[model samples]
Structures are given as structure tokens and as C-alpha cells.
Target: MHMQTKKNILFLFAAGVMLAGILGTSCKKDAAPDYGIPTITRVAQPLDSASIVTGSFTQWVIIYGTHLGSTQSVSFNDQEVPYKTIYASDSSVTVQIPRAIPKDVTNTVTVTTKGGKATFSFTTVIPPLQLTGMLNEYTAVGDTLILTGANFDLYGLDTTATSVTFTGGSTVNIAGGTASTLKVVVPASAQPGPVTVKGIAPLNISIATVAWYWDNRNFLFDMSNFNGWNGKTYLSSGPDPAPVNGPYFKVAKSWQGGWAWDPFCSNNCAMPAELVNDPAKYINYALKFEMYTPLNPPALPLKLYMVFNSGNFKEFFYDAGGGSYPYSTGGKWRTFTVPLSSWGNLQGFTFSNPIIMEFMLKDSNPSQSNFSICNFRMVPIN
Candidate 1:
């Protein structure tokens, strides 16, 4: 009719140009993706940073290698550490830090993750090298003193802190270091009281420098010797005797022939027999007795004979007869803590040279046994 209506308009313009080239090849294969500029990974800072303690603990950090995940964050010095409590599959972290971080310092640690940000600068936490002022009351053998205070600047008086020990063979020779002072030389079988300074090496790795001393009021002990046990003096061996209660202190089953005071202290058996004068002012004080026995007692081999000041009784035998104060849950109430420095030279005996600490309990496995002495105390620990 008009050439068949222009051949149906040229077949609808070639089907609209084949549907616009198939929507431009499906929008160039579903486009939308640039994602660039992002690739960082840095994390390494942990040799065990902060230190110094008077009390309270928890400071362990390792953070070595291997896919450290969990979108991290740990900074301290630049702030923003918001109590970071994390275990995170063990990349290691305990961080509680702050007991002493002074003296010529430096401390910084940043760790932001997702593969980015890492910084480290450490050193600073020194306050436990204090060997206070002491005017000496008695320190035998070639005595040469003067061991002042303030971190002694890593103490190197005579090459790695040359000499200082006293348990009976004495040795002291630090002769050096002076900003505050430290020039020692008291080595003559040194004994007599208070001279326990410490620090061999370790200003890092959580910190360690304990052994400072200077409170030698000459073997401290007061409150009229804790009001009881008659001016102190009671060892055992004559019919089970070494009692005190009102402050708890006992160990009676004597040991010559008696055997059975452990697990049978008649509830307040006169308060363990009385004499522990709670004079709390210890420089390193210690005394905690606890006993328990009877699984089949009566002699499987047992012997306990205690005597101190009965003539300096071997200077306070800590353990030799058998029950220097046994503890393994035999009857119950078990808690021994004797550490008057193990009574070397009869530690702290001075109510005018008075000391009589005793205890003796034996059963020699004969099968007629029983034992018990629940609690006793004389505390102070650093």
C-alpha cells in the first residue's frame, strides 16, 4: 500500500536497534567497584613494659606474631586505653601497670589494628630499690656502711653490685654510686639485724628489685610480749608442754614419749595456750602454725621435739626431729608459716634477750594416734 507501509517502518527500526545493544552489555557487566588505598600491617611492642610493686598484681604482655585479630587498640601515654580487657586467642595481654613509673622515663605504646598503626617506646618504673637510713645497732666483721636510697642508678658500685649478704658468713662491698649515696663494706660474719637489700638485675620484664631494709629497731616485738606465756620461754619435752591461747600458740604432745596433740586441742584449749603478742610492725615478720594428723596414727614413724632458748637450743631448730610443723591434712586445720627468717641467731629476740618458741608432736606409727591444732598467727609479708 505505500510499499507495504514502508515495510512496517523498517521492521520497527530494526527492533529498536536490537534493544539498545542489550542494555549496553548489561551495564558493562554490573559495574561499581573501586576500593583502593588500604593495606597496612604493623604490630610489635612487648618486652614486658611497666613495673614496681608494693601490692596488687597483673602485668603480662607478649604480643609476638601471627595473625593478631579482633580489631585491636592499646595505647598508654597518649591516652585512650579504656580498661582494655582482652585475651584474644593469645596474642598475649594482661596490662594493669602502675606501681612505680618514675626516674628518667619514657613510656608509649600504640596499637590500632585492622592492619594499621603501631608504635613503641619504653622505659620507666623504678621505685623499689630503697635501702633506707640505718645508723647501725650491730653489724660485725669489718663493718663499712652507707647504703642510701633512690634506685641507686642501677647500682654498679663494684661491678654488678659487688657484695652484700648476711646469714652468718657476711659479705658487703658495694663501695660506689653517689647521687643519694651507696658505699658499703660490712663483711664480718654480718648478723645482728636489718640489712637485707636486694637487686641483682631487672628493671624490665614486669620489674623486680626487692630486698631493701632499714627498720632494725633491734629485733622488734612489743605489747609487753603479747601479755601471757610469762615473758616468753617454753620449749617441749617434759610431758607435752608448749601452750598459749588468747593469741593462739601450741604444739603439745611433747616428743620424748608423748604423741597426740594434733586434732585434739579441745576447742579453745585455753586458746592454744596463749602467747603471740599481736605486735604488728614487722619488717618481714612471720609465724603461722597449723597441724593435722590421724589417717591411721599411733606410729608409722614420727618424732617431734622442739626447744628454743632452753640454752639457745641449736638456735631455733626449724626441722630436724620430725615435726618442725608438719602439714598435709592429717586431721584438718593445716596452715604452717614459720619464717622468722628461720630463726637464724634466734631472730629478733629482745625483750632483753628473751626467746622461747617451741612445738613438739610425735606418734612413731604405733596406731593410737590423733592430732589437731587449727590456727595461730604472727603476720606481715612483702
Candidate 2:
């Protein structure tokens, strides 16, 4: 054979061998073996052995079983539960229950792995009870107290089964209730402290502190009627132009170097005789009022003066310009509550015989000075 032909034949043989090797490697496969269905032995806390039949939303739980190492997904109540794979193991998987569990469905936790899925049944409850506020926090014995909150079992689902107890005292009488409101009469012996309400059947408890008093009263001034304000000039009066619509008092101040306006309520304004006659009963009280400015005013200092029958006075200053108080209504009305205790010793001034209530406004800048006031009231603290 010629030398060139021999070389050509050898090159062709080598190329054929390389092609066969490439084909053989491409056809090779190492697929994972199929394991049998996974088994769920129990559901519990990660570090504790106590099994839980009911859990709140957004709670983390542990699933113990066989062949959970390859868990691909998890679901609660047939709804997909987002999870992380780092906590999955051959015998256990840790997952967080979905935060938005359907309120109307039964709860079932399902874990899916490479082998199969395992499901466990349980009850899922809503978020824990929260106390928002009260319609009236100050009440005397035999008075009805209205409490507002979430998940209170208020609808008389089991009238005799639900119980309300005042802390450090006996259970008070529950007059009526709904999901968000509970009406209870303050017992004569009930002390000033936290009140706890527990529901029936699937029991849930919520607690709130109430201010109870023997001589509780609300001295309300609905600024809509300005007849009682003596010798005071209001720039105008009409329906509240702000977002919180109601009757309001409008006072305008010019840029003055000193306090320019003082609005005073005369001593003849009707006040509870007990509040003025008994010093002990008036000690525990608070003053609440609503104030609004077209916008958050700059830090203009405003003062409240409590004039006494003895010619003595006490003063509390708040930044009408939204400085020190750190609270803003954002063009809405802002309700302020000042505890009597915050005023310290009032220089022996008798609160029961207050002669006047005055509002002082001072502005130094050229900007228009304006604000509205309403709902001035004094309420017992406890």
C-alpha cells in the first residue's frame, strides 16, 4: 500500500473510535432510585415533645417522619405553605404555617417529598386576642363598661360559659357581648386593675386595664355651643372644615411678640358639684380635648391655664406647631389626654372649685396663626 493511503486509513480508524466513545458517554444514566411513601409519625415543637392540636397563624412547627430529607413543598389546610429546605432532614422537616389561613376551612398540614406526601390534621386559630380601646374606661360601680377588642366571643355564643374577671377581684357580670364589644357591669368590690375575659369551648383570653372610681364623672363641653365662653373672641364658627367634621372653635392669632389671644370659660359654666366640693375625688382625673390646625402648624407654643377660686393657677404648655408633643393629626383632629398627676402639686389649688379654663396662644413669625378646638372634658382616672 502507498504511504499516504496507509496514513489516511489509520486516521479514519482513530476518528471512528473517538466518535463511539462520545456516543457511549452520552447514553449513560444514573437516575435516583424511587423511595416508598413518606410516613408522618407526629407534629410538634422542634425542641419539645408536647404535641399541638391547635396553633395560631404564622407559627413555626416541626414534622417528624421518615424520608422527609427530600421534601419539596408543604401545605396547610390544602393551601401551599412557603418553606426553606435547609431545615429538612431524613426524619424531620421544619416549616412555617401560612400566615393567611382561610377562616372557614379545616386545617390539614401536608408535606411532600421525593417519595410521597404525608398529611396531618389539626385546628388553626386566628391571631391572639388584642385589646384596642374602650368606649368608656372610667366607670363607677354598677355602671356598664364597654370594652372593645378582637376575638372576645362577644355574641353570647355560650352565655353562661364565658367569664369576665377583674384582676385582684371576683368575676364581674357580663351584660352583653359581640365579636368586638363586651358590656360588663363593674362590680362594687372590683378594684382598679386589668380585666380578663375568657371565651367558652375553644377558650381564648384577653385582658385590659380599666380606670374604676367611686366618683367617676365626665365633664363634657361640646364646643358647638359657645354661649358659655365669656368675653372671648373666636375668628369664626361653623362646621369643622377639617377631615374630622363637627362643630369647632376657630381662633386666629397675628404674628405678635407676646401671647396675643386668651379664650376663657367663665366660672358659671355648669360643673359637677362633687368634683368641686370634694378634694379627694378630684385628685385622680384627666383632662382630654381635641385640637386641629389646617396643617401641622410650626412649633408655636400654646398654654392651658387652670384658674382656681383661691386666685392660684396651674399651667400646661403644648407646642401648637407640632414640636415637643411628637404627635400630629396630619390635618385631622388630635385628641390629647393629660393626667392630673402630670401637673404635680398644683400649689394646693383646689380642682373642685376651678374658676376658669383659659387657652393662651403665642406666635412670633409672620405666618398665619390658626387652630380649632373641641371636646374639652375632665374624666376620672380611676
Candidate 3:
């Protein structure tokens, strides 16, 4: 009986050992597959596909396949990329790239990882074209055009630019933005159809289609702010000494110089006047006046004295029939052109000082005479 009991115990122990071995093997088989430390299989980045935008920023390339947790960082050129969100369980990292890299045929991206280092190359592509401001569909020929755009060289509009070109014989004056804006003039040669302007290179797109106005004068006349003369100040009526009609200014009258009605008095004289902000010095030197002869003409002969800064009025005196230049016969408006040459050549007066023109409407016969005055404009002959 003792022998039998020992044998039973031995058999049971052996069975228990076998059962534990089988269960351990099953657990090991059902566990999980091991993909060995994630690896970088030929890391790469989008070729220089960066695009230009009109706003404050631009878009750039991104790298892929730098291995999981092995990747320490992804950078452009050499600048460290600030940590952005990691995507897909360590598969990739999405980041905002910088534009400091110089544009060229090829750019570099560096990916550093625990596994190793990999470099990718891409060519920077030109950005797409876009238009901004002034979206009028139609622009007429001979109309002044102000084109607002971007990406142009500073030395004026490049006629040979591949992206954008002018349709008509238009002339564009460019200013502001290093090489980005164009102020173009619409040409008369352009046809009435839809005219197109394109920006070149990266941005090859049409900006605007301006309609041509056939008659600009008629259009301007209909405008409420329209005036026969250029936009300027005008005084038509006030006191007796003022001009006789609209579009006239009392630059200098007899009241200021005491030359109101008594044409013969020394004080009743018109003074010389100089232009305020004349660019061309010639405009400042010469004097021009349009006058209308009054119905009650002055009986006394009047002389207009053009005095330079040097007090030399004798040299510029107009010769009347009797050693006195007479005022108009008082009937019609007449245009008088006077060249500074008539004044003894003193390099004409400087624009800094006002040209004092004294009108000596003195009546030699002591008879009171008067006349009406009109507009005056002095333009450079050149």
C-alpha cells in the first residue's frame, strides 16, 4: 500500500508541471507583435513648394517619415522648429515652418533622430499671383490708371517681366514697394473689348478689366464738382474794385496801391505779383494778365509798370502812342504776353522775392478813367 501511495503522488506532480508549461506557452503566443524600434525609411520633404501671399505671411514645405520617438527635431536650413502637436502616435509632427531661408532652386530640410540623421532637398517654387484694391470692371482709353499690385523691381515697370504685361500702349509709373506695385497709364490704342493685365513669374494672373470712357470731357461736365477751369479758388463778385466776372481773382488791385478810380494819381497803381509756389523759375519771372476794356474807358493814358527786384521799371515799360502806354480802349477782353527779357536782364528776379508789378494808370490830362480786369495765369514757356 505504501509503494502505491508514493507512486500516485509522483504521477500527480508530473501532471501539474505539464499543465503549467502549456498555459505559459499560450500566454506568450497571444501577447503582441514587436515592430522593433521604429525606423526612418528614407526621410523626405516636399520640394520647395512654398507659395507667396499678399497678407502678412506665406506657406512652406513639410518633412515626413523621420521615425517615431527616435526623431529629436525637424528643422529647415538650421533653425530649430518650435514644438507643435505630434500626430499619429509618434508617426509625424506638424509644425509651422519659417521663411528665412533664401529662395533658390533647392532648399534643405534636416531631420535628426536617435536612429540617425537624414536630409531632404526641395526647390522653392514661386508663389501664385493675386490682385488687390480698385476692382473697376471697365476702364476707358485715355483715362488715368492707378494700378496697385505686388512683386516688382524698384527701377520702374519691367517691360520684359514674364508674369504681367500691359495690353495697350500704356505707360506705368511705379512707386512704393521694392518691386511690387505698378501705376499704369491706359493707352488710347487699346480696343474696347475686355482688356487684361497679368502679373508675371510666380503670380501669373489677371488683375483688373477697366472699361474705357469715350468722352471724358462730357463725363467731367456732368460731375457736380466740375468747373471750366482747373480746381482753384475764384472770386467773381464783391466790391466795385473786384473782377467783373467768375473765374477771376483780385491778386492786386488799385485799392491796395491807392490806384482805385483816379487813374492819374501816383498812388492809384497796380503792383507787381509773383507766383507762390511756381516750380519752374520761368513762371515766377514772367507776368501775364487777361483784361477787359470797360465801356467808360479812361480818358487819361495809363501805363503798366513791371518792376523787378532792382527797382528798374523803366526798362519794361510798354511804349504807348505818346511816350505813355495807354490802358485798353475799354471795350473788349485782350490777352497780353510779357517776357522778362523786356526787363533789363538781371537774371529775372529770384522766385523767393515777389515781383512788384506797379500799374501806372495815370491820366496825363487829369481825366478820370477806369477799366475792368479779368483772369491772369503765368505758365513757363518751356
Where is the poorest 10-residue window by lDDT in model 1?
265-274
lDDT of 2 by residue, 46-73 (tens): 6788888777766788888898888888
Alpha carbon deviation, residue 381, candidate 2 (Å): 8.1
TM-score of 1: 0.28
Give the range where candidate 2 is weakest over 10 consecutive residues by summed lDDT. Answer: 208-217
lDDT by residue (tens digit), candidate 1, 233-281: 3222222212211123333233444453332221111111112342223
Residue 51 displacement in candidate 1 (angstroms): 18
Each model's number of backbone clashes? 28, 4, 34
Arrange candidates by lDDT, highest first: which order? 2, 1, 3
Comparison by lDDT, 2 against 3, better one: 2
lDDT of 2 at 11: 100
**Residue ranges of candidate 1 with Cα displaced over 4 Å:** 1-104, 110-127, 130-193, 196-357, 362-382
Indicate which candidate wins on lDDT: 2
Once fitted onto the true fold, the runs of candidate 3 whose alpha carbons sit more than 4 angstroms away are 1-285, 309-315, 319-330, 353-357, 362-367
Predicted structure 3: lDDT: 0.40
